[model samples]
Every structure is written in structure tokens, then in C-alpha cells.
Target: MSKLTIKTLAKELGLSIATVSKALKDSHEISTETKKKVLAMAEQLNYVPNPYASSLRKQKSKTIAVILPEVADNFFSLAINGIQAVAVQKNYHVLIYLSHESFEIEKAVVNHCYSGRVDGVLISISSETTNAEHIQKLQSENIPVVFFDREFESLEAPKVITNDYESGYLSAKLLLEKGCKHPVFLSTSLSLSICSKRAAGFAAALSDTGLQTNNYQYVVDCTGTQEMIFDQVKDLLQKHKEIDGIVASVERLAMQIYMVSLSGHINIPKDLKVVAFSTLETAPILNPSLTTITQPAFEIGKSAAEVLFTMIEKKKHSIMADTTVILPSTLIERDSTAV
Candidate 1:
């Protein structure tokens, strides 16, 4: 079969090449009815637009960048799938950049987006990210940005996030209901908005239970190398033998707790109940079947992408006026947190 082109679409529809071209670009000059006909024929013929020509004419890269802290987490992997689903439908390409949980790396990645390489950006801020200057700079360059998961609360960009505070309260409440006397919250960064919210909720739960948060609930930083984190967990368990339950801010910390418990011969639920914010598919298969506060990762990704494309297509200066969408995280009970 001959390569499909706008000329072929024009010839088949008995329309002028100029009309077909304008319709393909969704130009206002083309009537809605005519645009539909052109689009339908294009779809029927499996026509693929020459992105290079389109970009030259429209000054768009026909691509978007997704900057993430890391892909090691199941949540990020699922989110990527959701982002890609929308990108494919819009005939846009996705460029994924990982910051590896480093502030410098994230800043560098954000800086690279200023080169007009991507039409828009979707980002989940790094745990170490404290400054919004890089993001502000990206916006200054007219690149629309949508945030998902981790985000700087100060930024005016649209954010798609889960209800971290509520989820934290629920997780801590679950442990307390299980008769936990000493519970701890583990987080990588206290500076992160999500972590702070979750930590606050965890503390609130303790306060409501007639327990002094200072005595019963403490937030432990688990940021470092795998070995360092493992050691931290081990030390935490060893130093505080009274620790009856743990609420991990992220999945990695939860896994580390499990490892520490296994090596230390401290049984889950029996000795130390564990819960975490996770989207792990293997949650059900873990030895104790991990309990989790499962975030709507995929939905968050899809929503962020949709909002970003809306900004890109409409040529909006900022989505600051757009309301932030906060989805709830579900608390799933399992053997790990079983009474």
C-alpha cells in the first residue's frame, strides 16, 4: 500500500489539499463537519501525520516529558502506564527522566526541559527537592507542567495527588485498633509535603488515642543506601523493642521492615504490625501478605496528563487557577496488620 498522506485524504474526500491540511491541524478555518469527515477518513486509512512537518508548522515538539524520582516503586511503574495511555491516544510521544531521588538530578532534568524539547511536562518531585526555582524557571519558558504524587505545595501548577493525611490517619488508627502500644512512622523526607501530611495524620491518630505522640509515635528517616536503610530499620527495631507497629511512608521502607523482622526473628503482626503506602502487585504474595494504603497511582497519572494536555492545547499560561485533584488512598487489611 502507498504511504498515507494528507494529499491522499484530500483526493479521496474530494476536498482541496489546503482544506484537508487545515482540518488535520484542527484549524478554525475548517468547518466542524468538514473536520470530522477528514478525521474519520484519516482514521480509516490509518494515517500517521508527519510529526516533523507538523512541529515545524505549529512550533510544537509533539512530545511531553515525565520526570520521576525513580521507577523502582510499583506506584511509579503503574503511573507511567496511565500516562502512556493518554499520550498514545493523543499521538504524542513521552520522554521519561528519572531523578533517582536526588535534588540536583531533578534540577538538571528540569533545566533540560527548557530547551523547547518537550511541549509539556509531568513531574513527581524528588524527596530531596526543597526549592521550586527550577520548576518556576521551566514555567517561565512557557512549558506547561502538571504534578503528580510528590509536589511542592508552593507551586501554582495543577497537582494530582492522593489523600496522604487521611491515609496516614487510617493506617495509624488500624495499628492502634490492633492494640499497638508503640507505633512509629517511617519516611524518607520530612520536607516532602506528602510525608509531612502523612506524619501529621499519624501523630493526630496517636493524640486522639490518649497517647502522647512524643512518647508513642516518632517519625524515623529511612533515607540512604539500601544497606544504610536496612541498618536504620534494624537499629530502630533493636533500640525500641517496645515498637509494636510501623507505618511506612513508602513501600521501600515497609519492605525493609519486613527484611529486618525476618532477620531479627521478629514476626509481623505478632511482634510488629506493618502498613505502608504502596501499589505493589505482589502485596498479596508477601510472606505475611502486606497491608497497604493503596494510592490511585494510575488515576493520578491519567488526570495529570489530561490536565497537562489541556494546558498545552489551549495555550494556557498556567493551571494555577485549576483546582488540585486529590484522590483517596484505600487501606487494605492483610496478615501483616492482622490482629
Candidate 2:
């Protein structure tokens, strides 16, 4: 079969080439009825417009990039689905980049995007990201960026985030109410905004309970491989018999804690009550049923995509520095934190 193009459709429909082109581009200059007719004929003729030609005429790549720390977890996976839903509706392609929680990789991807490979970017920054220079450079190149899930608070860009501070405070408050005196918050990073904010919220809760700054130990920072984190948790449990509660900043840490507790023969709830910020589908089916501060992963992703598209429409940095969307998270009680 011959390669079906716009010229063939125009010839067969008895419409001018200009008219067919405008209709295909959805230009308002063409009437709606004309557009419908042209589109129907093009479909019947199996005419496929050259994407490269279309993009060249519009000066747009018609593609967006999604930068993620990792997609192995449930939260990011759900978030991707939400982003794709919006991208499909807008007839845009999505390019995915995984930074693997490394700042260097994230920076490299940002630098690549600066070449105008994508029209816009949606990012969940890596835990090790401190310098915003790489991302700022993308803005300098006229590419719009919106952050979701993880973000740099200092960056003056739109962000879609969960209520981490409130969720952390409430998780700690619940543990205290359940008769836990020495609850510890666990984190994989010392610099990540989400982890630090959650820790601050936990500390704030303790202060509200008349605990002095030095009266109670609150945060325990752990990093490296899963075995290393597991070892750190074990050592912590070994050193502090009074540690009766745990607030994991993320879900993987919560799982590590559960494993450490089980191996060491420590009873959950009765010994160490636990809660975590998680989007795990298995939270309700864990051996003891894990308690969680569940974030709206899907909503966060969807909101970020919508904001990025809005910026894409402006074709420049139209995002207000103060523009932020904070979705609330829910603390679901389970056997892990049963009183």
C-alpha cells in the first residue's frame, strides 16, 4: 500500500492542502464541521501525518519528561499511572528517567533535557540533591518544570506534595497516646526535605507533650544497602530497650524495621509500635498488618502533570514561585500500632 499522507486525503476530499493542514492541526481558523469532515476522511484514508513535520511547524516536541528517584515502589508506580492518564489526554508522549536516588544521575538527566529534547519536565528529586543549579539551567533553556512527591524547598517552582509534616506529627502523637514513651523516627537521608520535615513534625509533637529538647531522642539516620539499614535498626534496638515506638519516614524503612523486629523476637505493638508513610498495597496484609500514613500518590502525580501542562501552554516559566499543592494524607491504624 502507498504511504498515506495529508496530500492524498486533501486530493480525495476535494479540499485545499491548506485547509487539510489547518484541520489536522486543530487550528481555530477552520470551522468545526470542516475539521470533523477532514479528520473523518483522513481516518478513512488511513492518512498519518508526519509527526516530525507537525512538530516542526508548531516548534514543539509534543513530549514531556518524568524524572523519578525510582519506580520500584508502589507510590511512584501509582504516580506514573496518574501522569500517563493526563499525557494521553493531551496527546503528548512521556519520557521516563530514573535517577536511582543519585544526585549525579539526576543532574545528568536535567542537563540532557536542557537540549530541548522535551517541552517540559515533571520531577521527583533524588534524596541526595542539594544544588538546584542543574534544574535551574533547564528553566534558563525555556523548559518548564514541576515537582511532585520529593522537591527542593528552595527552588521557586510549583510542587505537588503530601502533608508530610502533619502526618508525621499525628503518627508520633498516636504512638504517645498508645503509651509509647520513647518513639524514634527513621530516615534514609539527612538532607531530603520530606524526611527532615517529617522528623521536625515528630519533634514538634514531642515538644507539645512537655518533653524538653534533650529529654527524648527522636531521629535515627540510616543509609546504604538494605542490609546496612537493617543492621543499623538492629543496633538501635539493641542499644535502647526503652525505644517503644517507631515512625518510618518511608515504607521500605518500615519493612526493614518489621524484619529486624521479627528476627530479634521483638513483638510488634506490645514491644515496639510502628507507623510509616507508605502507599504499599500490602500494608493491610502484612504479617501483623502494618499501620501507615498513606499519601495520595495518584493525586500528587495527576496534579503535577496538570500544572506542567499549564506551564507548557505558556511556553515559558509561568509557574509562580509560591504555587504549591499539598494533598492531605491519612493515618490508617493497624496491628502494627495497636494499643
Candidate 3:
């Protein structure tokens, strides 16, 4: 049998191609009776609408892109699930791109999105991304962009983020209240806005206690290979025997601390206490349950996706460009930070 097409459907229905097309789309122009007839015939004939052709006609790809630094983080994994939930409900396709924490690679991926392959973009930028020119170029092309988690403050794009600063402050206060005299902040990226905000809040919390934040050696940058980070953590623990508490800015740093403590025979919550920003499912199952500042990662992604679709459907860039949605993170206490 010959391949079925809209032309065939129209011929079989004794109707014009335009009429058949509108009926297939359930356009209001087509009466109920006609739409029923077209739909019945389409089912009988096993006729499937070509999404690509339909998208071309409507000038919409019916697709969105999600770009992230890496998917290895449980946080990003949960965010992808949230984003996918919205995409499925909207009957839109999702394309994910990973930049592996490279600014140049992220820029290259953004450049590729300019080819009209996607209707809009949702991005959590790389740690090394200090420039926003590539994102601005997308805006200049009239493509809507939504930022989530990691974002540049200078960008005039919608942002869905957690309260990093507040969470940081709370983490420090929790440690201080637990009788920690020397608490240090461990972060992978000192330049990233989220890390800076978190570190600043941590410092502020210590400063409020009359501890000289400047002389306390409060922030430690752990950006490097896994081995290098482990070595750094080990050295920090050895050199600062007074460091009784730690605020890890990421889950990896927290895990490294655990490993270092084990090797050094340092007892958790006795010799040291630790709290971290984490979405790890294994946190509770660890040797000592880890205390965590858990961000609403899934909600951030869902909100970002919803905002991107709204921009695409309504073309309300002016209203959404300056929009910022701040969600709250939760502090979950566990044995790791126990007094």
C-alpha cells in the first residue's frame, strides 16, 4: 500500500486539505461533526500527523533545551526529573546539554541553540561562566531564556533559585549553637555567585558571634581534581586542629570530609561537625547520617520550565525578563552535626 498522508486523508473524507488539516488540529473553524468524521477516518486509516511538518507550519519547534554544568550531581538529576514532568504535560520535547564545567563549552552549546532547534532554553550555567554575552545573544535573537540554580546577576532573564545566603547563615548558626568554635566554609567555586553568597552569609553568621571573620580562616576553596580536593581537605584538617565544624558548599566536599575524617581517625561531631548543601539520597545511609541544607532543586527546575513555556506561548518577555523566583532550602539535622 502507498504511504498515507494528509492528502490521502482529505481525499478519503471528500474534503479540502485545509479542512482536513484544521479538523485534525481540532481548530474551532471546523464543526464538531466534521472533526468527528476526520478523526474517525484518521483512526481507521492509521494516519499519523507529521510533527515536524506541523511545527514548521506553526513556526514552533514544540521543544525546549536544558543546559547544565553536569548531571553527576543528584541535584541536577532531580531537577531534570522536574523539568521532564512539565515537558511531558505540555507535549513538548526536551534536549539536555552538559557543559562539564567549561565556560567555553557552555558558550558553544548556547551558540548551537541559535539555529532555531529549540523554542526556548532553561540553563544552570557552569562554574567558570563569568561572562553573559552568549546568553545576551540568545535574548537578542528573541529566544527566551530562563536561569535556574547557577545564574549571573547581570543577566536580564527569569531566574528560579533557592535562598543560598539564608541557608548558609542557618548552617553556620546550627554549627555555632552546637558548640563549634572554629567553623570553616568549604566550596568548589569561589567565583560562582551562589558560592559567594553562601560564603558571605557564613562569614556574617560568624561575625555576629564576635568572632573576627577575617582572622578565622573561614572560607576554603576546594576547586580541583578529586584527588587534589581530598588532599586539600586532609591538609586543612591537619593544619587547623581547632577547626571543629565545617559548612560544605557542595555534596562532593562533604563526602571528601567524611573520607578524610575516617582516614585520620577523627570522630565526627566529637572532633568535628559537618553540614552541606546536598540532595543526595544516600545521605541518611552514610556511616554517620549527614546534616544537609537541601535546596528545592526539583521545584526550581519545574518553575524554570513553566516560566520558559509561558514566555514561549505568551511572548511576554518584557514581563518575565526581570522576574526572579526565590525558593527556600530546608535544614535537615542528622548525626553528622550532632553535639
Q: What is the C-alpha lDDT profile of model 3 across 219-305, one tens digit per residue? A: 989977677888999999999899999999998888889999999999997999999999999999987999999999899999999
Better by lDDT, candidate 2 or 1: 1
In model 2, state the lDDT of residue 18: 93
In what order do the candidates fall by lDDT, top score first?
A: 3, 1, 2
Residue 80 of model 2 has an lDDT of 94
How high is the lDDT of residue 134 in model 3? 96
Pairs clashing within candidate 1: none
Candidate with best lDDT: 3
Best by TM-score: 3
Total backbone clashes of model 3?
0
* Residue 113, model 2: Cα distance from true site in angstroms: 1.6
Q: In model 3, what are the clashing residue pairs, if there are any?
A: none
Which parts of model 3 are misplaced by more than 4 Å?
Answer: 1-54
Locate the minimum summed-lDDT window of 10 residues in model 2.
314-323
Candidate 3: what lDDT?
0.91
Supply candidate 2's per-residue lDDT for 79. 96
Task: Report residue 330 deviation for candidate 3 (angstroms).
Answer: 0.9
For model 2, how does the per-residue alpha-carbon lDDT over 23-71 read when each residue is reduced to its tens digit? 9889999999999999899888778777666666767888999999988
Model 1 lDDT-worst window of ten? 314-323
